[model samples]
Target: MPWEGISGLVNLMGTWMTEDDPPVALHDEKAYVATPDRRLVFDSTSQKTLETIRPEGGQPVSTLKRGDRNNAAPPVVTDGSSPLLLAPFVVRQAGTGTQASRTVAELVAADAKTGKVSWRLRLDVADWTKEVTDSLAISDVGASANVAVVTLVKKGSETFSNPSTTYAVDLTTRRVLWTQETFKASVVAGGVVAGTKRKAASDEYSTPTGYDLTTGAERWHDAAEYFNTYLRPAGPDLFYLDARDRAGGKNRLRLVDVRTGQTRQDGVALASRCRYDGVGAVVCWGRDEVTGIDAQTGAPLWRLPDEKAGRVAPRVSSVWHGRVYGKTSNDCIRPRPGVTSWRTGIPSEIDLDQPWSLECRRQGKGRALAAAAGSASPGRR
Candidate 1:
């Protein structure tokens, strides 16, 4: 899709194709279809309130005519039931944008029927010196909800060079509940566990810390440097992989507990990624190997014989419906003898139930060659 701005008729016509409608395209969850009576709404971190657009009689609406700015990605419309919250702000260096650019956070809420903005909230968080990565956290606690966590970044403006802070905001109030300055920590993968459901976040800071859902208060914390990549949490033990910095590179693998702040895991280099498979299965991939670790005690369950699993070095993306999805890069957990290439291909989702079989399959003619070559073939070839 075009990154930003409007596309003319020619471009629109050329780009138009029969694809599934985006699940979110409406202000209200009940208004799913594109109807003249209903309005379309957009909410962003920059635009804190929601914006609405509606039809003017039989013609197009004025707001609809306006191009989508602020949001680099097309504003994904959703049935209001579940809104696809987007990145809040463009984390540019401070002093770059004019005073007008000083505006830090913006939010819009729109009228469901007329597509007019019901409310708009904008604020200035001052000039940021360091480049801010787009990472927003939204959550609901009790009766109130929060929209932006930008304040947390602003609070630690002096430490902008580090750019590692765990921020939690109550969307209902558009207020920051807590901002924890982490050393190298972040909100864990999967997302911050508030009540029951999972929430999308900007960064996965390592330190496991809690903040008051209402008032910004530190409730609990865990050192991130002590662990590798923060995997999802288990009961009392949090599952994660740790990387061992070596001469030229590092090796990563999984660890259990280690909350005492010690940085050691039985000499197992931190896996590139580690995730909970089901109740017991903890899937982990290191240099040239993917193994299922015991979720309860962090023991090695079964190692996938694929020697390239480490080479694939897929970041454990997600564990859903019994499958593990990951994206691999050149910073492989284990690099092969002569391969230094980086690729982000869809690796097979390892299925925990079928522990004996490779869950992901190769595609096209490559699959045949892979089957014929067995484990001897190089993946990059």
Candidate 2:
């Protein structure tokens, strides 16, 4: 198809029939260019299938492969990663030249004109027809566009121990820099840091661990009662993670530096997520109201006072910037009107230099509790 519709309404689209290769991604206003047959790219605009593209006379790229080895979950895009990553599959054939089952991961990257194969790292399958369980993860290091951390997990047979491994792959070299056991991981601050939960005791408090991207070493470990690694675009110091210590009913906001691993009181007690409106300026969303604060000292900046404060939750909440934006509960999926704003406050309103001023009131409550924005994140393996 050719360019049609409005002046600025041009879109490129394609699909591949083969399997086990990277896909292609078209630059803006480019032609129906194909990637090398050995490559494929995931078109988020088009569904989840990997579409194949061949650059005129280049090799054929396979798209839309399966990863049904041992009933593991299918590959889904992580927060930040180039091209795209897919889980391996075990293909089973029923007839001539027809694939019935397979296990492979498809990585797709873009190039100058026609996208080329950065690499096609196949899943290490032991048998041809035996069942397999595998999982894959990809993380984009915000600093460099050419490097990505890829991880894969494979389960052993019923009689063998569980088998899994994580590989930090270089997209430019198509080489594995390091490999280790699969650790439950989360990407924070645009993939600058990998947040993993490390609980030393079942009955004791939980802690958060931050690993360096370059060396894969633990840079900082939070052992406090309510400390966790969170990623928000506040500064160049990896991210500003919120931590709070709960005594009776009060939870204070403790801002932690991802680089130095030091904690400071930001005084902006948010029930959920908050963002910096400006330098050292914080806009916190609460269950009932939204408050701005000083980004550096964590002092109240301003309060977008709630009109009907009694109906909303006491905790802070947020709505990320995307195609749409609205307030929702910290854990709720649906956005409601009464939900508090996560990033509505500014640092110029409050006096971190002084103390937060608020007129307290209480009424018949149902689920109102004090929870800060920097609460600990559970589920770290």
Candidate 3:
């Protein structure tokens, strides 16, 4: 099939005849397509093959490698000059019984243009027992300044026991800068924001920690204990929601200064689910309301109250330019008072003016919001 007129297939594995496969668009008019054994870059306009990229050392490493179920799409980062691909390779040991397999996770960087391997770093595995099966998967990849942040989840056989680790790699020198261990982690502002959970007999809460992306040194740690919290990249700051009460009881929406580890403002109480709209605001939905907050300062910008009766609730799906696009639930709009719209469904958009209210709504039928033209959507990748 022709993918956006940017890529098409030539053949599939084990076939001499020409076939078609989906293509990955890189930049400009160039796209990458997979063959039986290698990946080829071709021009979309001219329909001419530009380059054939085979794995170095005959080891399979292409994101389009066939039959490799664990392969993930390599994240591409740029140093403001050229794109660099962060390729992940999984080496599984052959064993049985208590001798569980050992997985070697590697992070390799290659030049996007020449497809030449530049640097490789072996990611460390979490300490595991022989009886436990362990595996590692790349969860996130991001870059800021001269550092590239890669997050991996080291999972064992036990449920909910997996801990994610974040590694900061210096792109200029191609060296491992630092690493941090947390339940989850992401690149935020100029540093790394990591979260860890602690469970006690009386209380269970999570903490958000900040680290310097360059040196991998601990910058600041929050002393507050939250029932649950989610961290998101908000430009140079971190936007987070902390739930103190369960089941739509109460939530705090705040923006953290990644450098100072402080809230940009006294965060206001809002719903648990929220999305950053790339254009300097975040939209959150509750039982009967939708809200917009400034991404940088955490100040309330607008509020839309929905007094409609039923179990259906309004949800902000995506924000583009200055518009908040979302949908409304068809079930019970007001299933219960104080309930959130996190899981509710529907499609709608809200005007950003004061006393915000629904500007657009599609009842009964729903359509997913499209990405804003000429701008990237907010939140995290």
Judging by lDDT against the true structure, name the best candidate: 3
RMSD to the hidden true structure, all candidates: 13.9, 14.3, 10.8
TM-scores of the candidates are 0.42, 0.43, 0.60
* Highest TM-score against the true fold, candidate: 3
Q: Poorest 10 consecutive residues of model 3 by lDDT?
A: 14-23
For residues 260-368, write the lDDT of model 1, one tens digit per residue: 3222244443355554433455565556655655555555545544456543333443342244443343221111121211121224322122111122222111111
Model 1 bad stretches (over 4 Å)? 1-86, 91-103, 107-161, 164-166, 181-185, 188-214, 221-269, 275-281, 294-299, 306-319, 324-381
lDDT of 3 by residue, 1-381 (tens): 122222222123211121111223244454544332244555657777665544332233223333333222223345456766445443345557887555545666666665566777676545531223234456335666767777665543211345555677777887777776554564456555444433421234556677766876777777776665555544336555454534444666666666677887555535554555545666665556666667667776655553453323444444444554443433212111222222222233322222111232223322223222211121122
Error of model 2, residue 311, in angstroms? 14
Model 2, 73-154: lDDT tens digits are 2122222424333222222223336644444443443332333433454334233113342232222223234444544333
